[model samples]
Target: MDRLIQILKDPLLIAALAILVLLGAGELLSPGFARGDQIVRLLTVAAILGIVAAGQNLVVLGGREGIDLSVGAVISLGAVIAGNVMSGNDAAILPAVAAAAGAGFLVGIVNGLGVTVVRIPPLVMTLGMMGVLQGALVVLSRGVPSGNAAPALMAFVNQPFVLGIPGILFVWAAIAVLMAFVLRRTAFGWSIYAIGSNERAAVLTGLAAGRIRTILYGLSGLFAGVTGVCVIGYTGNSFISVGDQYVLPSVIAVVIGGTSLAGGSGSYTGTILGAIALVLLQSVLTTLQMEFWSRQVIFGATLLVLMLLYGRQARLRV
Candidate 1:
């Protein structure tokens, strides 16, 4: 049964199985569980999470306790800014997107500078950024976000075309392909892995650790910004707490995908599966009418179990 064990140990397989189990549970609890519309909706939600998790994955893959806590905040702020700028106008879509991306990039740069130049701990730096962004959102929106999502965003996020495929799915697919290529085939990608594996060794080997890590943080922000833009399309509006739910979930998705918390190993493909699995779990939980607190407990418990399992495996390997 060595082959069977190996297959079971595969992260993608595990994620797929988790999703299938959840789907089965959902089907038992609710009719039309895998109906066409439900499937499309599930994919849409997962695609958004996958976009955010891509950035989180890059940050953690940079190692040294790298994590971007500000992602949720950036997403909220970006959505707000984009919604205000677009103001339901199709012609303003380009500007709205640019503004959202710029905001996220700025936050990322600040985070990167704090970590690399100021020598602050990444956790503290990102957490501080998160607080700053949250306060900023509250102040700017005055506790309530205004304006509707731009028409272009609505068309892309909520509209379906050609066999009922979501427009957001195409965007997610593009990002996944690009990220997979960069991580697996590019020189800079190799530098990130080397740095995460061992910073000092990477430096000794002529790798630019600080620069690469900084860029990774920036890319993380960019992806988070993209997620924000997608949110406006999907939800049709922005709010102060619009992204509050995503911070922990993004990290959880990355880890569940078999990316070690200790860094140096992961794949976008695995992350995609993890995202899908989490969404399926949520669907099942909702179908069962689980309370919000109960869902939180379950999510937390699941994350804790995964962490322990991966931690043990890493130690064993060492």
Candidate 2:
């Protein structure tokens, strides 16, 4: 009984259990919904969201009300930039990736400056940055989607590469491993936690809280940009709104994965399970023919409930 109680207290375990329950419900609702191939497909979709949430995770972990409202916008911009750069040429893939990542990083740096140097609240700064990116995308695209994903890019993302798992899953797995290592074993990672847990004390201890937080925002943008590249690859084309749907889901994934909205306590492992659970839930709802707005309502409700249950803690001292 004690062992079981201990497991239940772990957020990662809870998220894993939620995934199982979601999968079971899906199987019951749709006979083949839980089939191996189908689950793999759902996981492929989840991998994309997980990558975006990677950035969100870093930002949220840095505290100071850190949340990147501009991730979706950055993703859209990155996709557009990548699509144009790739132009269906496999040889140009590397260049396209560099361009996408660089653009996103630059934008993220600006956001960090706004939040730290200018003293703008993270919410307002990121929200305004989102608007700015959207406008830039509109002007760049001239109201029409342009550029094609290279055939090889598409295959890399959607086709099985090893052990029948899609290649994108491999990418996500690598990212997950890297994130876990960074958060658990690195000095930078420790600094993030220290700042988030108590910024005033962290600063007094000589940690460069402002600089670290700025880098966190930059990393968030960089991740979003990479996700945009993956998004274009997955869809085989670039659309203005390809990434818009992911904005809220990314944040939700981080929060539900047990990351404190108050900041400083969470794991990428939990986020991974949270991402899977969310994807499974979305798959189940889609199978049930839930309307778009209805699904969004459920997403919002789920986030709110999770916030109350797991994230309603004392705000960190700034």
Candidate 3:
């Protein structure tokens, strides 16, 4: 009984259970809610969001009000560049994807420099960066992005392998495993947590807090870049505002996964489940044929309630 209670008390497990319950309820309202194929499809969509949230998770763990507001813009820019560069050609795929990721890395470096060297607050710096990317994308694309998603890119992301699991799922799993190992078993990861938990103390103890933070931001940007390519693949095209839908949801997923907004503590495992839950929520909403505005309201309200619940839980644990 004690073990069961402890399991129930775990926020990540609770979130997963909630997803199951919602699926059950959805099944009652609509048949085939939990069909195997549907679940796979749902997970595939969630995997993209999860990939983006992974980066956000790292930044949150970097502490000092660390948050990457430019992710959506980065995604947009990456997709635009990839689309233009690839032009639907299989031959151009690798180089185009590489270019997109490289651009994202550059953006990440700039963001890191702004926060670490210029001493700007993360929120302000990233927001300014977001606006800059958005404007720059407009100028570069001249308002309309050309070219379709490369066939090769789409096929690779959508490919099925190893007992019918999606290639994208494998990609997400690899990233999740890598991040979990880094956070749990690495000196750098330890420094990240230490700095986030207490920056002054960490610095005094000889942790390179600034360098770690810069690296975290760079990783976040890299993930955003990959997410952009996924978005383009899924949609078969790129356009302005292509990634705007992800910004808030990525944050929500991280928070719902039990990552403290104040930073210092989080888990990629929790975030994976959180991403699943959010995607399931979207499926439920869509099943009900809810309007877009209603979905947004519910999303916001749900996030608030989850925050309150977890906040109270944290206090009780303390």
Candidate 4:
């Protein structure tokens, strides 16, 4: 019993448990909840959140007050740009895709530069970038996003089929697995923890703290671009604030999964679990016919509760 309580105290374990509980309850409450198609649809949504969670995990795990506030803006801008660049040509889609990705990278670099070179706090740097990027989008799109993405690109993302499993589910799962490997198995992975644990100490010990911070932001940008692309595939078009909705959800998912906001600790598995739990929570609430505002209220309450629990842990020394 004591051991179980201790395990529950661990963020990753708690997140996983939340996933199981929510998922099981969802299955019990909904008709055909376990059906492959329904499960796939739920996973499709979860994947979108998970992809963004992966990037947020990097910023959070990188420490030194690192966080990516511009992720939503970056994604929105990327999708809008991709929409314009594709302009109904399947072949042309790749170039615009590259441009969209490049746009995200640039934003991330700006974030890193602001934090490291300009000495702005991460929050302020990203908040400023978010507004700047949104303004840039309006300018680039000429007040309206007129272009359409290629048909093939849209079909690929929306259609779900890969060895009898939904393509989107498998795609996101594959991404999560690959990321898990990278973080757990690679040398650069070590630098994430080292830098987060003690930026000055890491710098003294030979890790390029600034360079790595910059690169992590770049990685965050790169991931944001991928998410934007996937979303375009899912929605077949772009709106200015479409990608912005993901910002809070992404951060919340990563944090709920047990990745410390203070950094130097976390796992992709936890993030994945957290994403799943969030999706299941939404699914169950929708099934229950909860009002939109009420759902938001409940979400706020849940977050408050989690914060209280987490705060207690943060204040403890064990």
Candidate 5:
């Protein structure tokens, strides 16, 4: 108890543990919890959100008051575009995949430029980007998002191998491992953390804060693109605002995972854990036959209490 309290007294650590305990406890009580399938489902949800969280994770790590408001937009755009690549045939899938990824990269770069060169506030810039991307899609898509989903990609995303490990799960896991290493082991990683903690100090210490921030944004964009591609495979078609809802949840996932909202202080592991907590809540609520709106209301309230508790780290905005 003493050790636990000492840990939670640190706001960031508390957020991470709270999510894990709540969700982990729920998993213990779930019906037929011994079933391997149930375990798979839990991990699957965590993997899906972890991919999205990974995309946002980079944005958070970029520092310089950074946050990617356009993530939802990028995901939606990729989904809609990938659908067009399907042609209801398998051989044409590669082109579609390429197109979707390319589009994601372009959008991410735009976001990067808006932050680095344009000098717009990350929030305001991404907010505008959110609108712009949505508008462009609306103009091009004409209120209906239609596209063919590539079957090969879908298989890659959903197919299980080596004792039922879904490829997507592997992909997400690999990315997390790679990112954690980069953040902790490499000089670039050190620069990212240093810049986030104190951009000015980083500058004095001879870091290219602008370039690093730009690359971070670009990397974040690329990750989002990859996520969008997977989303297309998972959904099998593109629909309007399919990725729209993920924006806030992605942010919450990272913050709730114990990543400092103030930047330069967090773990990708926490984000992964946090994503599982969210999926667990959704699953438990559904199994118990709870109303969706009620869940939303309760979720909102709970988030409020949590924010009040651990959000002191956000005071770094000044």
Candidate 6:
């Protein structure tokens, strides 16, 4: 009983329980909502969010009010870049991916510089970066149709690859493992936590807190870019607004997964479960035939409640 209680005390475990409850509610309401195929589909969607949230997790973990509001813009631009580079050709997929990742990385580096060097607040820096990227997208796209995703790429993302799981899920799983190792077993990861937990102390202890936080922002951009490529694969096309919907949800997933907004402590594993729970909640809401605006209201309420609960604790820690 004690062991069980201990497990239940863990936020990750709590998130998992929430996922199961959401699943149950979804199944009860929609009958086939929890069926194998349906669950797989939902997991696939969650994988994309999870990937984006991975970057968000890193930024939040790096502390000092770290966040990458430009992620959505980065994703949108990455998709546009990938689609144009690929031009519906399977052979061009690799090049397209490289272009997207590279572009996103450059953008992220700029964001990092603005935050660390220019002394801009993270929220302001990233938000401004988001606007810049959006404008760049407008100039590049010029109100024309975007390019199509290669059929092969689409298949890889949507079709079952191993044991009936989408290939994107495999990608997400690999990222999760890599993230776990980096956070648990790396000096860089330790520095992130230290800096986030107490930046002044970490700086005094010889950690280059600014540099590490900058890298965190860069990685966030990289992940957002990758998500953009994946988004095109899943949708078979690209648009300027393809990534607009992910920004808030990515933050929500990170927080829901138990990552403190104040930074210094959290795990990608929790974010993964949080992503799943969020997807399930959305699915359940959709099943109930809720209007789009109404669903947004619910999401807003959820975020508000989570902030009150988690944010309070985080503030106390500081």
- Which candidate number has the best TM-score? 2
**How do all models score by TM-score?**
0.96, 0.97, 0.93, 0.91, 0.88, 0.96
| Whole-structure CA lDDT of model 6 | 0.89
Each candidate: RMSD to true structure?
1.8, 1.2, 2.6, 2.6, 2.7, 1.7
List the global CA lDDT of all models.
0.85, 0.91, 0.86, 0.80, 0.74, 0.89
Better of 1 and 4 by lDDT: 1
Q: Comparing candidate 1 with candidate 5, which one achieves the higher lDDT?
A: 1
Q: Count the backbone clashes (under 3 Å) in each candidate.
A: 0, 0, 0, 0, 3, 0
C-alpha lDDT of residue 84 in model 4? 81
Q: List the residue pairs that clash in candidate 2.
A: none
Please report how far candidate 6 places residue 11 from its true position, in Å: 1.9
lDDT by residue for model 2 over 1-318, one digit each (tens)?
Answer: 999988787778888888999999999998988898998899999999999899999999998879999999999999999999999999999899999999899989999999999989999999999998888888889979988899999988998888999889999999999999999999999999999889989999999998999999999999999999999999989978888999999988998899998778888888888899999999999989999999999999999999887864755546
- Poorest 10 consecutive residues of model 3 by lDDT? 309-318
Task: Compute the lDDT of residue 137 as modeled in candidate 6.
Answer: 85
Q: Per-residue alpha-carbon lDDT of model 3 for 65-95, expressed as tens digits?
A: 7889999999998888888888899898788
Q: Which parts of model 3 have CA positions greater than 4 angstroms off?
A: 1-7, 311-318
Better of 4 and 5 by lDDT: 4
As for lDDT, the candidate ahead, 3 or 4, is: 3
User: Deviation in angstroms for 269 in model 3?
Assistant: 0.4
By lDDT rank, best first, the candidates go 2, 6, 3, 1, 4, 5
Candidate 5 TM-score over all chains jointly? 0.88
Prediction 2 TM-score vs. true: 0.97
Deviation from native of the Cα of residue 16 in model 4, angstroms: 2.8
